[model samples]
Target: MASPGIFSEVRDPSERVRQLCNYACKVDIDEAIPPKRYLRSGLEMMRMAKVYQEEGNYESAFILYTKFISLFVEKLPKHPDFKTAPQADVSAIKKKVVASFASAEKIKAKLKERYTAIEKKRQEEEKRIQEELARKQAEEEARRKEIEELEECKRQEAETKWLEEQEARLQELKRQEVERQRQQEAAAAAAVAAAAAGINSGAPPNFLNNQIPSAPPGNLSYIPNDFGGSTKLVDIDSQPAGTGPIIPDRDLKKNLLINDGPSVSSPLPSVDRTTKPPAYDHFMSTGSSSGNKFGLRDVIIPSDLPRKFLVKAEHNTLKNIETCGILAGKLRHDAFVITHLILPKQSGTSDTCVAEDEEDLFLYQEPRDLITLGWIHTHPSQTAFLSSVDMHNQYGYQAMLPEAIAIVCSPKFNETGIFSLSIERGLVEIGSCRQKGFHQHNKTPPLFEDSSHAKTVDTEKIEVADLR
Candidate 1:
């Protein structure tokens, strides 16, 4: 018979199976039951089933246990230990074992179902988290784009306002200039009319009407006169009497009568007025021919060339010549210094060529010595560059000024053009490198070849100007 603890005492079926399988071979049975018969007995068969169950062969163990229970019930037990050799109640034991097996199966099924449900929940939670993160990222990206667009709009609006203000200022300046020109024309007409009236009235032509007092006759001596009666007269000479004028004694005639004055034919000998006269004779000397005189005077100094920022040369020599027109001025009085070369508008293109206004140019003065003589241009295309005409022009320009620089801006390549001359030595082929920062090497082919063997080209030098 099976052990009593197998089902009645063992709370865990798995533990019961382990105990039975371990003690199965040591259990002693009646010799009336042959050894082979004993091994095949119901008790032994049940132990074998439990061993199979412990080994994870649940289907085989369940079948073996069912058959053993049925056989045990059909064959009654006749053990000597039984008081009256009561027949074994195998039906009840069989029912209990079948119920344990069903319970184990149900437990296994519930565990599998729970595991599946947990895994599904975990996947759903992970997906939710990922979706939330994506949503936040998208929201942030949208906000960033919105802010950028707003900033761009604000910048564009400010630029538009600035342009409008500049246009208004330009219009007002043009009106003022027109008014000034009208006034000038009116003044000129009035002067002409006055001259005509003087001629008609037979009066002496008063060409000196607007002239101020003249300076003294000597080259170094200055004359003093009351100009608007505001400044005091400062006499520059202090000397003894009868010494003659300040003019050197070597040439008396050259320093005497500067013009046909009233004292030209006076009988007094020519004497330098710089000599001191007697204190008592001061009043009398005032009326003498050599006394102080007054007349309209003009002081003239050479004018500077008009300030410009661009000059085009026709030949290579001309292009190389350093011209004042191409120089840029230094910053003066919080003003900007800008230099630009404008090209004519291209034909058939609706685009208008814009240039910096004269008002902007008037804001600063350029340095006269740092002028750049850029390339010349004809109306060939709506561009500015060294064409054959430009090269010829540069050759001529270079001959005049060897240090001149040239830049040719062509519309064909838009912003890319040839700078035939660099402020530094050599030509720099400027084109779109599509890069940032300073260029370390040239990207284009050399425009000119060396004069030596002619096989290799000596590119233009790139260096900063040594401006003192």
Candidate 2:
């Protein structure tokens, strides 16, 4: 429909219907209606049609227009005043109908143009809104990436500072240890010297009472009667000696001398000493069993999985095993179980076709004290030593719960196998088997059975197509 004029000169269908109904009701059954009134009613009906057409109510306008034309034709032939009325009036009414129809057409055309313009504007607005949203999302992503980069940089800086501090402490410890050794040596030397001086000064001399020959006779000879009594002389060498004093042997003295050299020469006392201030034992005990200085588990652990899983598993048998495990553990506990949903990409019909379903597994966490024996999944193949995908999944899975084992099942025989991954001497391996229940007699030995083979696997390069 064409756009209506600002003054509403165009007629509307409902108005036309009301005008017709009014005119028809006003018609007196006792007296014949006047031609002017009938003509006025027709004009009003036409005006209503014009309004309806302008407003894009074509169906109602068409119906009203048809009724007005039919009534005008029917009454014009039989009315008493129809013949007496001025021909011009009849002509004017006819012209007005034609004009109204024409106006209705114009209104329709204008309306179509307006609708087209409005639709185009709407499309443009939607596009603009979408572009704005995209721009906002891009900005948000960039901001997030920037924040992450800043955090990583801060972490690296902290790590570097920590390493430098540790090195400085180690150097200081070495310096203190050297100083202590010097002091100990000095004290030992002083003690050895004191002992040596005491020994040298306390020894007894051998020259005692020996008789000299009679003073070489010469000096004159007066022999007294007292001197004539028996003269007895004892030689220093002739007496039988009692047990001699026990002196240190030469070897013993030599050893003591060598050992005492550093002590005697140094200037510091021999004593235990340390430069570092004493610290409380408890301070040293603050750390994880994994030896990681940072408590990464606190940050990476999932908070929502347990609650959501439990809600979804009220009727399911497996009962969201992982969620159960998470709840059983203590609050803010270190333990968490993560499961990855994996799907096979290829039908495995042909060897040449590379499977596209080789996507990484989705990770899900289980609640604590769940008494779960690790993750369980069915394998398409008969033999299940973790496939390349499985290994990749398990390794990442184990990072969150290193103590947990992985269970792989083969649906055909209902056979299930479990494997544990561990790090040993800087190498990743299927370290040990706690228990492998299925096909117990099978030749495959426990995990640690072949060290060489485990070490040969290059686990890092394996593909990890994250399904998430």
TM-scores for all candidates? Answer: 0.23, 0.27
lDDT by residue (1-468, candidate 1, tens digit) is 211112223334454344333322222233232222222233334443445455544433443544443333323244343333323324444554565456445534543454455456757986997797778778767776776676666666665555455345445544654575567667666777777898999976676662323322332321122212222222223533322123222222233322321221223443432322112211001111111111101111011111111223122113332221222221111111223332222221111122234223222212221122233222213354333333333433332222223333333334223233221222223221223333343323433222111011132212222111
lDDT tens string, model 2, 134-207? Answer: 78778777776776676666666665555455345445544654565566666556655655665789943222
Residue ranges of candidate 1 with Cα displaced over 4 Å: 1-112, 206-468
Residue 284 lDDT in candidate 2: 12
Question: What lDDT does the true structure give each of the candidates?
Answer: 0.33, 0.37
Name the 10 consecutive residues with the lowest summed lDDT in model 1. Answer: 294-303
True-structure lDDT of candidate 2: 0.37
C-alpha RMSD for every candidate: 55.9, 40.9
